[model samples]
Structure formats: C-alpha cells, structure tokens
Target: MELSAGKFLCLFALLSVVSAEIFFEDRFDDEWEKRWVKSDWKKDGDGAGDWNHTAGKWFGDENDKGIQTYPDYRFFAISAQFPEFSNKDKSLVFQFSVKHEQKLDCGGGYMKLLSGDVDQKKFGAETPYSIMFGPDICGYSTKKVHAILTRNGKNHLIKKEVPCETDQLTHLYTFIIRPDATYSILIDNVEKQSGSLYNDWDLLPPKTIKDPDAKKPEDWDEKEYIPDPDDKKPEGYDDIPKEIPDTDTKKPEDWDDEEDGEWTPPTIPNPEYKGAWKQKKIKNPNYKGKWKAPMIDNPDFSDDPDLYVFPNLKYVGIELWQVKSGTLFDNVLITDDAEYAKKVAEETWGKHKDAEKAAFDEAEKKKEEEEKANEKNDIDDIDDDDDDADDTDAEDSHEKDDDNNKIEEEATSTHDEL
Candidate 1:
C-alpha cells in the first residue's frame, strides 16, 4: 500500500522526533534515592558509601537536587538501571554536571554507561561497562577528561588529552558520539575536542598497513654523508699528547726529596694536541630520501561507519574513589538531540551559576565573622572570672567587723539597766 506524498512526509517527520527523544533522564530529585542503588563495593575496604543531596553550591537550591559525595577514603560504586536502548544511526548525547566543593585532591568524578545485564547492587571496578566518561584528577599530573569506549572486551581511551576543571565550582561535561564514528567532548556546552573514533581510538586493525612483501632495493642509499677518500690524516698526529706538563712550572720551595715526597706540576691541556684524525665526510651523491613502507589494504580490516553505536544500553553508573568528597552530580541526560542537551544545561547551570557563587561568598564571609566573635567572647570570660575572685576577698575582710559589732550591742544594753 502506497501513501500520498503529503502523508508520507508527515510520517517521516513524526518518526524523527520520536527517535531523537530523550531516552533517559534523571534530574536526581528526592525520589532518586529509591531509584539509585548505592553499591556495597568499596575499593579501600573503608566505607559508609553514600550520596548526599544538595541544591548545589553553584545553584544554591537544595530542592533542585544533586548527589554530593563525601570525602576521605571512599570508594563509591553506585548504579541506576534504565530501559534498554541503542545509539543506532542517531547521535548519542551524554551530559552531566560535577562540582567539587571540598577542593578535591585526588579522586575520580566519572560516570559509566553499561549495556546488557547488570547487577546494580554489586557494580564495582571489575564490572563491565560500555562507556566511561568524565573528569579524573590525581595530583597535577592527571587532570584530564576521560572518554573511554569499550570495544571487543578492551577499553579504548581517547588519544587526545583533554583538560578538565579542577576548581571548587560546577562544570558540565558532555560527550557526543555520532553515527559517522566522529565524536565531540564539550565542557559547559562548549566543544573542546572533536575527532573520529578510528583515528582517536584503536577500535579495529588499521585500514591500511605496510605491505610485508615490499622491501627496499639493495642499492638504496639512506646515508646523508659519505667518507672523502681525498682527505687524509695529518703526519705525526699520534706524536702529540692530549695533556702535557706546564712549561713555566717550578717545584714548591717546601719540597724535599729525602724527607718529603717530590712535587709534580699539574698537567694542562696540550696546545699542540689535535683530536684523533679521520677522513672528512662529504655529502653522499647517491643519497635518497628515507625509505617508507608501501601501504596496502589490511586484510583483517573492515569498515564499520557506526563503530560508536552501542546497542541495548541498560544502565548508567558513577563508580569512583575519592580522597576528599563534596562532588555534586546532577542533570543526567541521554538523547540523540544535541540542542536539547544544551538547552537543559543553560536552564539549570547557566541560569544560576553567578547567583550560586554570590551565595557561597556570603556564607564564607559570615563564617569568618562568627569565628572572630567567638574569640572575643573567650577573652571576656577569663576577665569575668578574675573579677569574681576579687569580690570574694572583700567579703571575707568584712566578716570579722560584723561579729565584733554584735557583741558590743549586747554589752550596751546591760549598762542601761544598771
């Protein structure tokens, strides 16, 4: 059955929107506590693994909802499983925000995308994942945005080194893998790096390789220089010594041959000395360019334009170790629409970043004032204790005078009766 031209066009557009729709999203609201499972798998064997809610110091709204990681020897491996989906020919968009309020030292702030079946409760470093993307900071040496893809049981790391934000502020990380095997990494919606998967990762054997049967000709000359037969070594070159006694030298006056050891002059570099003589080198007339291997189609290589595709994606996880916590993760989204992901970031982080910064500043200022006030009060308390001790001494001196007055009053009453 054939449809009318107008109806066929409408059908195509409708399917496009459906396919590009947001397949998975978690704003990490209050209800997210139930949806996300905190894995008992801790790497350090010291735990209390958990995720805290914050309005985000960057946003300053606890109700907006983001999970905060705690500090000090924690290995948090938590996962949230969703309905299975695949990249297909559509673009895959993954976006999320991370904030390190505690000024993290060395830790991992990455998230993972898993395929097929997964045990959410038991997810750990050993568990398989399809993709792992985010910033990882371990000292100054390793501050990079990791974009790793799992292909054929091996993890393919991004060839290009991408820098990440290390300040105690919020930053958005976006990874977009297109159907054409090209990918882009974005920081706060700005593209930082973009390239092809085949070039950036060793996903498959090279498309072309050096032909094993091809070899350089026997007469091929790679040398840039050749020995000059006309040039000869100078006569008596070996007669000159590399070092000789100073000609103006004289023994110290303190030296005595019988009772003391004789003094010898220090050797100086000989002026007549020349380096070991050799024939001079002239440019090689038969010099050819450096030999290059001839490239041929690799027999084991096959083209897969959609190497970035991952069929049956079922879960997303945040499994990492932290030395200092206070990392907030929020606004997770997976979709085929790049514009949609950008809009979400603008609405959430872009809109409130400045205000949140101001709020953080205000809080810090207030804390400083309170500490000063407490210090002043501590000094005042000591002064008050000293004043109380002086008052007690004055009361003790008055006690004897009061007892003598009472006896004098009783004696005066008996004199009036006499």
Candidate 2:
C-alpha cells in the first residue's frame, strides 16, 4: 500500500528519532561484558537457577531468552570483577532495581557493592561492608522507596527514603561514586543525598580482595616446565663479569670549606653583662592604719607566715563623711600582677580585709537560707510518715469491729438452737 505524502514524512521522522536512541550494549566492547558475574538467589533453593532478566534488556545474561523467575523472599548479588581494576579504577557506579515481596524485618536484607573474594574458598567469613538501608520495614511504610550510597570503604552512608508503592512494578536506584571520594544516591532518577570523606587525611583505601586461587598468574601450568638445578641457580650469574663497573676514581683526602667557594658562613656576636643590685627586703606594719612599706619589725602584726604591705592614701579632706566615716578597713588587698609568693603572703596577711568581711556576711545569709530549706523538707517527710501511720491504725480498727460482729451473731444462734 502506498502512503499519502504527509504519512510518508511522519514515518520518516519517527525512524530518525528511533535511530538516535542509544543501546547500552553497543557502547561497551564485548570484553567489557565479561567483567560482570551474575549471582542467582534461586540457585540456593532450586539447583536449576534463573534470574528475572526481563527487566534488564540492555545487558544480556548467559541464559537463553533473558527471562528468569524471582524467589519468594530472596536476594541475588551480581558483582563486576575486573582483576586489573585494582590498579585501574578506584571508584565506580553501581545501580540496580529492587522490589520486595513484603516488609520483612527491621533487619531488611542489606544490599551492598562488596568487593571481596567472590569465590567460596577465598570468601571471607565476614564481609568488609554490608551498608544498611533502614532499621527495618517499620522504619518506613510498606510501600516505601529507599536508596543509599556508601563510600570510603562503606563507612559513610548517604540515604534517601520516599513514599513508594511496592506493587507498582519496578523502579531504579542509582549511585554515583567519585574518585575524589564524594558519593551520592538517586532514587527513580531523582537526586537525593550527597557526602564526602576526601578531606579526611587518614582515610582507608577501598579494597576488594581476590580469590586465593587468583593470587598466581592464570597461565601457571605445573606440567609445562621442569625444575632443573642448573636453571634455578641465580638470575644474573650468566653476565656477572660484564655487569660490574671499573673502579677508576680516587677518594678525597680531607674536607675543605674553600673548595666550594660558592657558599659562605656568617660572623658571630659576643655576649655582654650588665650591673646587678642587691634586692631590698620589705616589712609589714603593726596596725591597720596608713599602708606603709612595712616597718623593719612589728609584734602587733601576727607573726604567722604573712607579710603585707599597706599603701596609704594621703589627701587634704574637707569633710569627715568624704573620708567614708573613719575609714573601716577589713579584708586584705593586693595588686593584680603580684607573684605567686607575693599573693600567698598577701592572702595570709588578710589582704582586702574589708572585702573578706562582706563575703563572709553574704555566705552566712546563704547558709541560713539552706538550713531553713532543709528543716522544711524534714517536716514534710515527718508529716508523710504520720499520715501513713494514721491510715494503718484506721484499717486495724475496722478489722477488729468486723471480728466482734461475727462472734456476737454466732453466740446468739447457739442459744436459740439449745
């Protein structure tokens, strides 16, 4: 059948659009495809294993038709192995889809991009990481969408949870991990959380252990070569004489600064001393009068290891009230920059005596208040005990009355019967 002119153009445009669509398999070489190793969770149950590969048409599996069944409540782990990847790549992006049969436990089965021995013999008893997604199904509603990305050996986790309907087919979870050590998680193609540990200087390198069998070269065949004693002697013995260098240069006799005139040293300066004087000794005043550079000796001042210097303030006073009504000095006083020894001496001598007196008065008032609070608490406790005792007495009296009534009734009945 021949199409109309407009129909032909429409068909042509549709084909052009389809041609632009990218096929994932076309981008990577066939060798790259071999890197992936598929794991079947169903294999653990039915020896004849399969996977639900219908959802991933971009990447084909070893199974024909690319269709498989999913287990009732099981998880499958697929790992991408690149033996050379150890030296080639440090960071990678692993994205996949997950649909649970039901909200199981707070211990929702964990999915992790683990890099360790995939072989059972070399597989470690404990994996280096099993980064968790949530506490349990209770952590979110039954139909919830969650995505998490763990980086820097899975120590750091970036998670995002959204309302999702479990029955609503399949959805994608994507993670992008960078070499700079920043990781991000995306659920359903929408960006979620992003974090980094690149700034931490003492970070551990992400590692994936190989199977013990993989320690040696793949081509190592014992039958190919025979061990001969002569062949096993040493590597360089064949050309040892030719490998040695001739000793022709003479050794230097002594070190000489002038030999290398390109460098120079600077002159040094001599030390100088100044005059020193004998330190003067100070004394304390006998009474709390004007503060004087302490007198040579005074008995009225306590002999206890205290040395105080009282400096007097001299002024021509106009009124008695201006001098603070006869200058009442109580506590000790000392300069702010006084040395430890000087401060001890001043404190022992009761420096700022007036200040100390005021402090003592305030402390006395606080003590009285505390004593009153304690007495009130004690009285409240006593009242509580008295009320308890009164209730007990009342209960005992009621019991006694009950017994007396029963006894009277019994005595009356016996008399009637007789």
Instruction: State the TM-score for model 2.
Output: 0.28
In terms of TM-score, the best-performing candidate is 1
**What would the per-residue lDDT of candidate 2 be over residues 238-309, giving only the tens digit for each residue?**
433322222443334453547844332332332221223223333322223332232233223232111111
Q: Show model 1 residue runs off by greater than 4 Å.
A: 1-20, 43-48, 56-58, 243-268, 361-418
Pick out the ten consecutive residues of candidate 1 with the lowest summed lDDT: 55-64
RMSD of each: 10.9, 43.7
Query: Which number leads on lDDT?
Result: 1
- Per-prediction TM-score to the true structure, in the order listed: 0.77, 0.28
**What local lDDT score does residue 321 receive in model 2, on the 0 to 100 scale?**
10
Name model 2 segments beyond 4 Å from true: 1-69, 73-80, 83-91, 99-111, 120-126, 129-156, 159-167, 198-418
Whole-structure CA lDDT of model 2? 0.35
